[model samples]
Target: MSGSRGIVGEKWSQKILWICAIGSAISLYLVGVERQTQNRFQKMADDLDDIDYSEKSGGDGT
Candidate 1:
């Protein structure tokens, strides 16, 4: 009986470890995608800032 319980406990612990590993992998993937999206947006904003908006239209509020 004790040996059976030890085996069961070991199986459950292995399952738990696998679950944690998969969760960590998914979290890391999401973080990587988020960082890539953020960098893309930041580059777009920088490009917009580089444009001379003042030259496109009259300087006056007209």
Candidate 2:
């Protein structure tokens, strides 16, 4: 509670900035188009969960 106008604490402000920067970098990397290590999560834009993992772990390996 630095100010009534909603100024964050100094330490918290730096932490928040760093988190935002990291988040942005990750977002950029995901759609960066380099594609060295493809994001498997984004591979399934249709479904939130990957069905293959479920089949392998839950279903018999057939």
Candidate 3:
């Protein structure tokens, strides 16, 4: 009985470890994707800032 219990515990621990490893991988992937999105958006915002909106709109700062 004791031997069976030990085997069960080992199996559970392995399962938990696998779950944690998969979760960590998914979390890292998401973080990387989020960072890439943020950087892309930041670049777009910077480009917009550099654009001369008044010239395009033909407005004299009014």
Q: Which of 2 and 3 is ahead in TM-score?
A: 3
Error of 2 at 40 (Å): 15
lDDT of 2 by residue, 1-62 (tens): 44743545666888999999999999898777656435544666434354666576795434
User: What range of 10 consecutive residues in model 2 has the weakest lDDT sum?
Assistant: 41-50
Candidate 2 overall Cα lDDT vs. reference?
0.67
Candidate 3: Cα lDDT at 29: 100
Per-residue alpha-carbon lDDT of model 1 for 1-62, expressed as tens digits?
99999999999999999999999999999999999999999999876655645446644322
Better by lDDT, candidate 3 or 1: 3
If ranked by TM-score, best first, what sequence of candidates would result? Answer: 1, 3, 2
Number of clashing pairs per prediction, in order: 0, 0, 0
**In model 3, what are the clashing residue pairs, if there are any?**
none
- Number of the top TM-score candidate: 1
Q: Model-by-model lDDT, in order? A: 0.86, 0.67, 0.90
Model 1's alpha-carbon lDDT is 0.86
